[model samples]
Target: MNSEEGRSRPAWGYQALVSLPARTSTPTRELGRRALFALGLLVITVGLVYFDRGAYQDNNADHVVSLVDAIYYATVTITTTGYGDITPVATHARIINAILITPMRILFLVLLVGTTLEVLANEGRRVFRDARWRKRMRNHIVVVGYGTKGRAAVKTLEKNNCNPAQVVIIDGRPSAISDANIGGYAAIEGDATRRDILRRAEISKAREVIITLDRDDSAILVTLTVRQLNPSAHVVVAVREQDNATLIRQSGADAVVTSSDAVGRLLGLSAVSPNLGTVIEDLLSSGDGLEVSERQVTADEVGKSPGEVMGERVVAVVRNKTLRRFYDPTVARLETGDQLVVVRRSDQAAAPLPSGGERREFGGRRGR
Candidate 1:
């Protein structure tokens, strides 16, 4: 059994659901351009009719054509809804109608209906692409929540070279999904505990599942559902209470993080010794501090001891899918296929350690 099998799980619960603003697409610049073009065409057509007033007549009145009448005539003619209340009488007016007015009407139609057609075409393309993406999605990671812990875990995964495109987010809140979409991750908005929602996320084909639901009960249910759907996939969960850890493990969680107890211990350590707390924090953080990384053992170091490896501090070794401490007698002599879990500077490039070299300590100021 794995060392994490007996660890306590946290018992955090989801808070009351809050309504978030629905995502709305703003008017595109193309639509605005089309509108302005159509407006200009209307204005020019009205002006032409107004100036050539002597060539036209209003059937309803004996009075000369007015600006309102000119605009009304232009509107109806361009819309192809000719009311027959206005007519061009002179030969020049008839010729101009065939040449200029007809083309203007065609242009107006294109501008007005073109936008609607483009919108529909783009929507069709989007649907087709989404369908294709779903079919090709496999060995991806599904994140059940977008809360603080979930977000942090995602960031860490991304920092460690995991592809953001392969990460799927499932959250109940629309705002959380919107945020995930904005960050370029695929997101499904629904209750994660539901089987249908998990199915929609392609849970069966996923390689890993991260459950960060707020409620311990919800987390357990989701874990059970996910385990049933994908028995082989690794499942990691966070709970707030220690007592519920066993339940989560029984539910088939491969790893459990007891957030409350971890935080409490950190606080106590910080109060007792500030430097020790800072060192632990540095080890947990990435980018500007020490980070924990795992890599396969190099061929040249196949028969060497972990203590003989220069530069990095090897904490543990993974061999044949089992973890062994660096100090373990069985692990003392490094093997060809063993994976080393070591602590190194976050910004340092990974390279094979030189033989018979001394260990180097990395500190914030020194690394900088």
Candidate 2:
């Protein structure tokens, strides 16, 4: 597509939609709240006019006032639609009109103007927030697809101490973007597979890109696009089929998670041995149960056997970006600058690594 494709894609305004859930309310909810308040004012005005029917004079009817005429009077009065058909002739009614009703009318008018006022305020905030984001967008993670897998990935990142501000979500579905926003994240709505959409996310400056699309083909396309944009970034892809995993990895994903195969394996294991599956699921799950974390070798742990390490169980070792099984003789003893992949309890905080430790994807097969 041409560079102007972003401009002509649709009427959806990306800048207008950027928001932090913690700071501001969505336009829809704000408008609804104001509308409800305005309605309440109308109800109170109607009650006041109807309850004191004798205080008002109606030109259209006789000296008596009906509920319908009271409602009509309140409606026209609050809206400043002076039909001249209704008048409050009593001294008390006129005094109430001067003191109370006038203020309520001013409030209703303020509420009406509030819609425009809030828009202007939010617009200015959006512009400032967008500028700040673009300025500080370097080396942040870009996650495409806010579906089940995408949500889980982001949660895992956050649980590992990753900042919510450091992660950006890209999804083609408006509903998914809304969900992400409600979760207190900035989300861009558009097809992530498109180069222009990826560019809008500042793909080139991103430190990592995660692709968890439902369709394997789409996952591959996004992986390719991300790799093309940011070659040095660590790209991860979660695909449904194992066959597509290889293709995605070849497309430049650092690691590939075969979702369907992993789930199937867990199902089979559960059928054969229930406890084994439960333990694995616990490791896969976040929080106090069990977690598999990759962290740097502490000074005391260095020059020691993996089996001698206290508490967490060392499952594997990552040396120079290569994964080595714990049983492998070379990694039997940890060395300085070595990274260990260990299964530890979530209640205890894992030691921070110099390179920013990451959580490994569970239930995935890889070459040692």
Candidate 3:
């Protein structure tokens, strides 16, 4: 989207969108491959002329075609720079030149010109692709920031069967945007605090927004803007200070993760009790060891106490959008409609998405 259309753009900033699962090749690598092909053609031409040296004439180095002369002749011929010093005198040699050398020359020139055209064509394709992607973007996730926390959030999403194509990134740093593109996610290059930038990402239509900006103030501003644009979108923000989490949540963030405090707590646990810390870390990390999952309660488990449930350890139960610890008296019995957050071995089969369950999403009713 144009800045003028957004009415909230900075004078110096512009939007650059990159969509996911992009099949891209570096310009240098493409060019190098083409160059090798061109070189191979030259080599073939040189070999043909050298083998039939008796049918050629080199005015500069006697009537005989030396290896050097054949190389020079091939180079000039393929480049269409016929210096007239080397001439194919025999009828067979002339025929060979017409049939083989001429086509190779044309192909070589086309290769050179095609490279330039490819670069321009790629730009037009990129613009067209971006337009299509923007039009189709709806109910997608927008990740504002590409730092460590943001990266981890995306990784977790992917681990849980989330398509990387369903995520968009918004970052002020060009390098971060580039990384997002490389990682197969559409990205907008600009400050997340800017409404125009968010609009470029189609934040109004996004299903969720994750803000992991460098500062708490920026996170709050972004949360407010996103909530203003999309009131129903579940907004999650990460802050360095625990004290700012409440303010961020008040600013419309559905959930706030204090990055610094969480890490510090982990460090403290690791220092005091290594095994407990390691187990906690394992639960938090995906893809190995034990994993925490949310699944719908089976019909057989209805009215059963949390302790009676088998196959996995039930830690919490969710019913009617309320979270209840498994040990809580209110959630002592598992209801058929309730969802359970359980800890299971990574090798175990994962629970399917429940008809009414929120995974990695904040689900408590908060005062607005």
Candidate 4:
């Protein structure tokens, strides 16, 4: 199993045991073998301990073997740290001693060595695979900044079940250390604005370039460079001020998120009409929030008025730099340079009509 799969599985205590019985018989039998091996070593060690007693009692020809001394000598012998405090005097006992424990000692060493080597081999293979992954990747998403919004975006992408191997991030400031959690996702340390740093991040091949830098100017520059390198890439730039949104969008960004405008409107609406705000919040959030969507009227809706396109309310229609209130969708005209803000009904796809208002691309296309 791969490391990720192994980690995802239940702990060893709960998982079904495998290959154990075939190699070593039942658990009882395995325990018995281990016990025998241990007992054999104990016997050889006890012989060594009694050897000391034999030395003092050689003239008497009788030496009592104490259990405590046997245990001490057993530990010393198994560890191969015999202190010379014990010696065997009887020739037959010494010869029998070597016969009993030497084979068991060799078997223990072999098992320990094999297990250690196997562990080392598995670890080495994992390191090699990680290195290979780092060297071979391109056209992936590279998050260039780290903050609450950046973290939320990364998490949302991950939650969508996107492959980790396809995402990369670049952030140089020490404050962006939290981004390290995405280690398996490609990462590099350097200034994102520097063309060389962007090149190292493989910006040319990236599918999406997100500029959520803490500073607006940095985001603007990053947006410009990314558009110049990969004009087709969908770039999402975050602007702290609402006015900067147009600037970022004009710099070749597909979309721009205004933090202040969103936050301020949310707070203001919540204060006057909390219930309405809650409903809107749900739509904006992952939950069942009201989804405010926009679609440019295509050829189908060319003759039809705004009411047919927006079944409910036509909040506002934009023509050039002018913004006009259009409460009545029936009277609103679908003309060039006109954008209709409509509330979605049931997550259904809205049909497009012939363009009459401003030529505006809502979801997919960006106005150049």
Candidate 5:
């Protein structure tokens, strides 16, 4: 294989180290409860045999029933695997066997077999639900890696009116999957870099994919796999190293966020001027001081300059999927399909732009 091909394939050692969460055979509480109940039943059956020792006899080797013999007899009876080695000689012993022992045996069977049946039933239901979900999934977002970045991205999407049901989380860690489940998101417990796992998540039909894997190589592999599976899906990835951003984008990611670089820049800004950093942070945060939002240009605002728009402070305009700054010559006249990326106070509601192409007072306080 060529050097590029070797670099693209996942390493065998890395795959071995990736700990995919195991499929649950049964819920923890249900398994514990059933085990305790079975133990209790065994103890009760043994106790019955001990209290009625004199009434029973062992048919093998001419020995009288002792504690050990009673335990053995109870085990055999509850399991319904009677060996014909123990017999009740007295009438009361037979009566006890009919009324008490039989019920305990039934209870033991229910406790043991019922748990297995429940596990099987749950597996069946999960399979059916997964199949149905995959069939109906479209325009859905697949979030690979439920780490801090992934969680924050999903939260932002949810805040913007995205449905939780439409977001699917994929993570290799059991804890991450548990967290996703607790947050009411459907999750797949497996490595996102694997083609089979992405296929299971129905990446081909996904509308968008957000990759937040810790390692740059894993993120790049996932981006390549997702792009191959769905050529049209918009892939956004987070990279820890700025050097890897270009490589990730080349692997077919639509957008690359260099987290480390951004954080470093913010820290530098804060060191130089604290107020400037604070203002930028406020704009980045949602429902805090100031919020950044993107909305389509209103019909009345078409053919008007960004400076003439009211309500929000238009910082940039997105036309034909390309960003143009407010002062850019291209954005001097807003078009019908243009989108405005603006900043406003968290408490303010956006109002329709006036039809006369006249400027109005910005409703939001510009900065803290």
Candidate 6:
């Protein structure tokens, strides 16, 4: 194929249709035909009324009004609203009446009824569909924002079988709403930082909420709103600045995603272990394969060791300011409130680390 043909090949499906060239006949002829047809219909109705007026004789005149009055009556009656103020005195006048008026009246009523019923039927179907969708959704991840980071988070949720239907996105931008399929997914248009919008998306009912907006302030606001609306909900807020991660966590986010920290680690890994970096990227960015998970060691997991509970291996641990590696069974003992980051395949199921152990002040650890 030539270069032009090769360039055109990529355009197909809905995208191709939208990119196709517009034809002059498409809009021009359609509008012209409609305008002409409406004018013709109006002229015919007026002519028929004039013909009917001439037929009314002196016998009709005794109780009759003017021709204008008869035309007004015809207009009102055709609208399916007979005021009953004027009556046709003669049998011939009512019998051999305007050819268009009766059928036009019937058509008008039919159109009115049809439009009304269609709207009601459509609204009913929407309600039923939304109810079904909401029912099938449980513990589904809800993501706020659809920027670069937010889109990445969505892919992660889907890769982990989070259920596409259960995923609800709350973003203020209309363009973001239009980008994805959005057919089965529920997306609300509003500022995620606003409490009303969060409530509208049923944040309290959401299993998890991830805020990945570009602005740190926006993310912080969203984290605060979600915490107040849903204290139990697992909230993950993204922070571009490394220093802001702790602030985000303090603002009620269960966890903070630091892009700087992540990219820095990734670059370091790529230098020492290129193959490992590739594997990690594929797992995080793709829809299948391995996934990253982080869970805080609660008071419940204090006494248990990592090997005893976590099926996956710990990648790293953040204890105080030091980075520690998972050594063996002895080091596996997790204190209460230690953050553990682990990597596991998507299909593999895992139980939470053991619960109910002695609390300690080893700071915290970030496990891979």
Number of the predicted model whose TM-score against the real structure is largest: 5
Q: Model 2, which residues run further than 4 Å from truth? A: 1-124, 350-368
- For candidate 5, write residues 157-266 as lDDT tens digits: 87766899999999999899999999999999998888999998889989999999899999999999999999999999999999999999899999999999988988
lDDT values, one for every candidate: 0.85, 0.83, 0.84, 0.64, 0.85, 0.66
Across 167-256, the per-residue lDDT of candidate 1 in tens digits comes to 999999987898899988999999998999999999999999999988999999999999999999999999999899999999999999
Which candidate has the highest lDDT of all? 1
Give one digit per residue, the lDDT tens place, for model 2 in 1-368: 88799677876645567655565577767777888999899888889888888989888777588789888988898988879898898999889888877888889988967675877688789989888888989889999999999999998887666888889999988789989999888899999889999997889999989888999999888888888888899998999998887899899999999999999999999999988888877877765666677777887788888899888789888888788999999988888778788877665555454445444433221111
Which stretches in model 6 have alpha-carbon errors above 4 Å? 1-16, 19-63, 67-72, 75-107, 127-138, 178-183, 268-276, 279-283, 287-325, 328-368
Ten-residue region with minimum lDDT total, candidate 5: 356-365
Clashes per model (N, Cα, C within 3 A): 12, 0, 0, 20, 0, 12
Q: lDDT tens string, model 3, 304-347?
A: 99888776788999989999998899988777688888877676
TM-score of every prediction relative to native: 0.68, 0.64, 0.64, 0.45, 0.73, 0.60
Q: Deviation in angstroms for 220 in model 1?
A: 0.9
**What value does the lDDT take at residue 28 in candidate 2?**
68
Return whichever of 3 and 4 wins on lDDT: 3
Give candidate 6's error at residue 217 in angstroms: 1.3
Model 4 agreement with the true structure over 64-182: per-residue lDDT tens digits: 64566566655665656767554455776567557855655565555444544555576679779766755676667878886777766676566445577787777886446444553
Cα error, candidate 5, residue 11 (Å): 53
Tell me the lDDT of model 3 at 158.
Answer: 79
lDDT tens digits by residue: candidate 6, 225-304: 88888889888888999888888989998778789888888888989998767775655554346655565566655677
Question: lDDT score of model 2?
Answer: 0.83
Kindly state the number of residue pairs that clash in model 1: 12
